[model samples]
Target: MSNKAGSFLRNLGQFSPLDPRSRTLRLYPLKFSRPKISHSNWNLRNLLLNDFDNGIRTSIRYLFQDPFILKSGDGSLQRKGISIATFLRVDRHHCPRRLSFDSKHSLVSAPPFDDGLKKVNVNPEVSGGAGLSKEINPPPISYRKLSQECNSLSDVLDIFSNAPTFPSSTYFSAMWTIAKRMSEDQKRFEKQLMFGHPAFSQLCDQMMKETRIMYYDHLLFSLYAMVKLGVPQNTLVVQTSLRMVQERINECDERCLSVLSILLKEMDKCKNVDVLKAGLRILVHQQVWKIESIFTLQTVMKCIGKDTSIALKKKLEMKALKELDRFSLLNSQHMFEALAAMNHRSVALLNECSKKVIDNIHGCPFKILVSILRSCRELQYYNLDLCKGIADYVATTFDIWNLKQILLFLISFENLRFRPTDLMDLLMKKVVEKPESLNMRNIIFILYVYSSLNHTDKCQHKEFLEVMSSALTGCLHHISSENLLKAMYSFCIMNYFPLAPLNQLLQKEIINKLLTSGDTEKNVSRLHILDVCLKLDKVAYQHAIDLQLPLPPPSLSLSHSKVAQVLSSLLGGEEYFARNVQLPNNYHIDFEIRMDANRSQAFLFSEADVTSTNLRRVAVLCVPRSLYCLDLSHPRGFLAMKMRHLDVMGFHVILVKNWLMEKLKMEDASMFLKTKIYSVEAHPTTDVNLHNTY
Candidate 1:
């Protein structure tokens, strides 16, 4: 070795074991400010002091300086570095460990050195640094060498094939990976890789190729992948996969089975009914074992009767009856299959099934049945025989949810094209027949439809409102707290639809319902009521704004006409709707209806009241002390909504209501006389007043 290198090695032997941290502390500032004491100079001093033991340092320097390394033919520095790294096996920390070699392996000789040169002595310093080591133990070895290595992919495959199954995690991961990989392959490759593989088939021999769990897991993966790949929803492979999964139900977990059940039902929700029908056919054949654990069979029975009763009483015009009959035939067979699937060999056992099974049968059968009902022309004709057939079927059955379904179908006939008179005729009959027997949900649904269509005609059967109200009150008692809230909210919203005219007794009943319902958690009930109040207030305010009526000031009174005070005691009124009101901003409302330009300085009624200008877009600004001036320039009406809610910021229903009331006052004779407004025709702008006309 050269003298410089030899000396460096000797110094390293003496200094390498000293703590690096201590060396760094002692050497840093002196090395930093003094050029002579820098790294190269430091190395030179060590080389001069210990010239005999630095073979590795000298060799690395030579490697970097070599002509081939400096000017590589391929010009790849990273390749060279990687080759060095592989050769060295240095960890990322740059600390080197023992090389893989055996004592018997032949060693290549080092390049010949000049005759005068002498090898550095490293043994003495190494022995000295170790204090009194008798001998160093051999370096640690890798554990992987203990196993026999497979030389080829064929051998690896054979190992798996001979085994009873791949490990569970490995098998599942393989299926997941293969399914994903299949999508990107050419069509031919996919067929060969997936369909031709015996491991993917359903029979026991194919299943024995892997565990049953693995096979089923792969089946799920395949089906899910098909959806993600945008295969035609009705493709044979997709359908086959679905059927295969359903066939393997006993092997699937309860949650998975539940999901499948839900999907089978929701298939109907797809726009293509044919897909739904096909899916239902496949699912109905499966024995959903978990059904007994999750559903209450008696509940379903109660619902079926209720729905049938509703469908029977629903008055259908000939046209609607015809439409209903048309819509039914296309769907009946599938509906019947779904309903029958819910029934098992034992009646007593039917009382409980997974909700998944019950709900599917409950909600879907009606849709299918509705389709069938539409196809029966005699029924569509609204013949007395058909109506009697429907009513008797409903009153006798026990399936309330199904009954709800049938009622909804009849209510469907309330569409504008169906004659309202015919619907009313059938509805009156039903209302009189089973007032007490109907469940609350069904009753509320009927009321919802009735209220929606009531309009001016509500005056004729005003007493029906009392019955409907009583029916809802009775229904509420039997339902869960969540349903009670939903039902009550639905009833209140339906009330807003111009049903029977508002009356004192009906108002009192509404208040009573609200109070009775509030007996649970006051805050919970209050929040629920507040939510309704905000919606109502928004609807009222929007209506007024759309009509351009002066709005009543935002206050507790308009929103909670029956229970604003009660709500405040629980929810702190304004704080509630101000933040949580669900009204859309773009909704149109009547905010500036009654302004008489001739009498008040606030608005100019003549040229400004053009049809093209939507005046409600204006923002109302409160100056100070109840002085409010609306900015007429803002875009009028509800702002378009980002989310669903009934309340809007900076707007309230009471103000809009008050504005409408004030607008009506302009029509009063006493106001005109007291204002001394005479010869209105003589006055162009001031003569026409809001309260003066409807």
Candidate 2:
């Protein structure tokens, strides 16, 4: 060995383990003002000299300097090159553990001979007043490593605070991965900390000020995760991500649109949301044909919604039809609902869907049937084979369903104007078997449906329903006025009137509730109608004596519907045709025309004209879309009853439907109205043999 190296090796051995002065030796610890170690001077602290290796000698001091870490806000935690360095502490005692290391996998070397700390070390009194000026280059900020090691939100803050610029896409993904691994509770807590804690906000601002190299999916997913994590969209991070989405919308695809669909509403409330939504729509309009997934297409349709331009809706509808065959039996409900949200559906598409539904009817869920049924009405797409299959399935599966299932099935069917005779029989028995499952409203609906079906004394339905009606008398105190009036109306229509129920409903308090109801005009008209029904039964007339139901409501103003306006302009004027004319028996007529002798001249007729025999009255009622049966040509009992009532009241009935109004010009609408009125005069649709039936 060289003489100098040999001398240094011999000198290293001079500090022997058995030295007598080791018992009470003093030491100094290294300290720094901040993590800026490159130019920071190393401060010192005095500590006890006592440290031993399993009762061995303590002549030589050993220390470890952990890595000088610089964590990033949103950087990946899985980084390489973090090494701990073992070094020496001159003195220390009764202090918290401090660990630091270098990024280069090397230990902190001892002070060189030229340094002042080396000379004063031999005599501690001289170094006690001196500080070390050694320039320690701080470890490189390996944020990727910090992100990979992140176990908490605090770690994320460290990375964010130290990052020199907005994190790149990969770094953000790594950070988000750390968050994803957290438990629900941890995520919730961390989310709260991010938005509620100002320090975190300030720390994240620097790194999330702008999206750096984030693509469409990255931006959307980050925004989605942050919102789902409880970070409000108003935050700078979320806003920046949203802006990036607009800037990169052309780069987005179906996956991106699907994610955006979920955040559409939430993001709508954020700042500058209009530009974002419009931009998204433009992007969607451009990329819609590229979407093939049925669910994604459905989401895209709903995201576009009903209020968008006609061209967009038509594009979406065409796309939906192309993807219709892609739907499975369970997901068929989504397809139907998507089409229903729109004002139009292709008849051929609906027919094909109907066939497909019936073919797969055996596997369809009960709730799915309900949605399909309801959507059929909304789209006015009806097929008897499909209806029959659904009815048979529901009737066969009756025992497994709850009351809600049965009622919803019936409600949808009722709207579609299909009387599920088989299902109704099964449902009636189910209700009789479980009366507790049937609430007051259920009973009232049953009564109304049974009455409309003209089932009085023909079968046990009349008796069962009468019993059900009597059972609701006990609930009169809490029963809603709407329900009570409905029950009474059903009984009135069925030619059966219960004195006790009628008396109880007419009580001052009940009458007040009915009069003060939110829908007062309808209620008052109903009250007058009930009074008229009571006059048919001598005994029931007594209950109407002191009943101060309001006078029959005035004929309603003409609606803004193009059909109504066209009908009025062709007839004469709004004043010439009484709109929303109500009969004494509560039959609703959309427009009432009083015809003179020879049916040449027409006069306006009001509710008071119900007793007029001098004029041949014509009732123009708009059969609501719901009143149309699945056949789309026939009316259900709800509507059929009105027709029967109008026929019995001695008025020829005419029906109006506002279909294809968008494409119908004023002249076509006027002709449509003329044909509708004249066709009824020549031959009624609801009552083909009206004069013979009456």
Candidate 3:
């Protein structure tokens, strides 16, 4: 070994195990060459001192550079090569523990690093002693990870509370994700947080600002959240947001249209008509000619009331018509309702809609079909081919519709004057199947339609009658007074007499209700009661069966002296005509005249008894002033409607105006009646009979 290396190894022998500082130093055996005989002349004391000084310098540098070491100023230590006793004294004050290394694994483990910095005081008189106060400051937490891993609303809220500022888009995305995964209880909790908390208002403000750049799905989610949060459509924030969307409608595609449609629908529910109109104006300006756009337009127009200007309504109608070819059944139904509400009719549009409805009848739902049918009825635009197709579809799929739908369908059929026996049979079969579902409305509608179509004979199905009678009896108290009168009127028209039990129930419930009521101004109700009593009396008298009900009072008669005088002057004399004459169908008229005045009795003919050859009778209707002024289009104007019944029953009708009788001299009145009734060319045989009567 070289002399310097041998001297360095010999200095390690001075340290003894019993010394307290000796345990801090760890030594390893070194293998050295014994002969560096050429360099063996070096001084052992000088080399040993130099080697010890180098070792001390290296230890001091390592200790200063260690990350775990605390430095007071400039990171400098005094007396670099201090004595071993001084080093041991300094280590006891600063370094509490020593580090150790494993030779086999080559790993080093140090004492735990103290990140808590202790404060030291320099003044000794003011402070009792040097105080060590440690302050802890942990690293900041990652909010991004918290947002992703959060499972409950509370966790998310806690994260939001801790975060000073977060990306609004990212926060909303996380919220929606959490909402979608939440259970019912969790959803309720979230609703509380979103609706009741102030943070949501800030979030909404952020959303409004960021909506322009936000993704379409994100925007939709934000809108849905706002709706579920019960944000009023008329609120400034909601209005501003909707207006912003409206301003950008030109860039919108079908997805935007869908969202806008939903928004307008909600606004409509809130009755925000001004906003709806504004949105509609924007939509129209964009000219987004799509079926969905048309539907939106129709919905808005309906809510805007029928007072919309003609020009704008016409423009919208033209737009809707232009897109009719692509409309679904629902679209067509909406368009029809809108047009009908606005009192606008486009025959071409209606025809196209009906064609589409017929094409899609099988896939169309019952509600849509009913709406279409009702529109057709209201507009009086009946397409025979369409009605036939609908009737066929309904007949084949009878069981799929509810009782109300089927009843409406039947009314539609009667209105269109289109009736199929099979469809009627199918309806009867349904009534028999679920009789319990039938209510008073259903029974009343069935009777009205059958009577209107002159098909009341078909209602005599034993099972159907039984079920319907029972349903009517059960719902007797629930039926309104107006509807009960209508039902009685319909029964009188159809000549349908229910079995004894239903007859007794109708007598006690409907008749007694009408008679005992103290409401004196119910003129219409009293008239209906009188008509029902007259028809029932005729029925019982003709059938020779007693219903045990008293006849109506004579004061209830509809005949007026003014009407009788007008008719008598027009019909030549009172002897030539019969007053209050009853027809074969139990419908009474003011006057009926025989072909020959010598014939004492006026002819009473059934529907089957009437023929063009045997139409030898002439009926005179002395309309009251009130009845004469009623609009023929109204269903309650029976005077105008009775003319049609008279024509169908093979009688040539003469309408004597009672107003003329009251206002004019008898000569002018007779002259006016002759011009209105007897001026027309008549059948030769009927002409002779009429000439003889006059």
Q: Which one is best on TM-score?
A: 2
User: Which model scores highest in lDDT?
Assistant: 2
What lDDT, from 0 to 1, does candidate 1 have?
A: 0.32
lDDT of each: 0.32, 0.57, 0.51
Candidate 1: tens digits of C-alpha lDDT, residues 1-694: 8666555555333221111222211111111011221233433235324422332223322121111122233633321221121011111111111111111111111113322212222322242223222322222211122112333222223333443222222322333334443445543354344433443322212221122223344455434544443433443334434444543434444334334444344332322333333332223223222123222211222122222332221211121223333333322233223233332122112122211222334333445434333433212222233333343444344335444555655564432112234445445555655677677666656654554443224544555555666665554445554444444444444343222222211244443554456554442433343343334444432221111112222422123222223222322332221222223322323222212323222233333443433332122111121111121111111111210122233322222223333333333423332223223443456545532441
TM-score of candidate 2 against the unseen true structure: 0.58
Candidate 1 regions with alpha-carbon error over 4 angstroms: 1-203, 206-405, 410-421, 452-460, 493-694
**Per-residue lDDT of 379 in model 1:** 23
In model 2, the runs with Cα more than 4 Å from the true position are 1-207, 265-271, 323-332, 342-344, 444-457, 537-541, 553-694
Model 1 root mean square deviation, Cα atoms: 27.9
Error of 1 at 284 (Å): 26
Task: Please state every model's RMSD to the true fold in angstroms.
Answer: 27.9, 17.9, 27.3
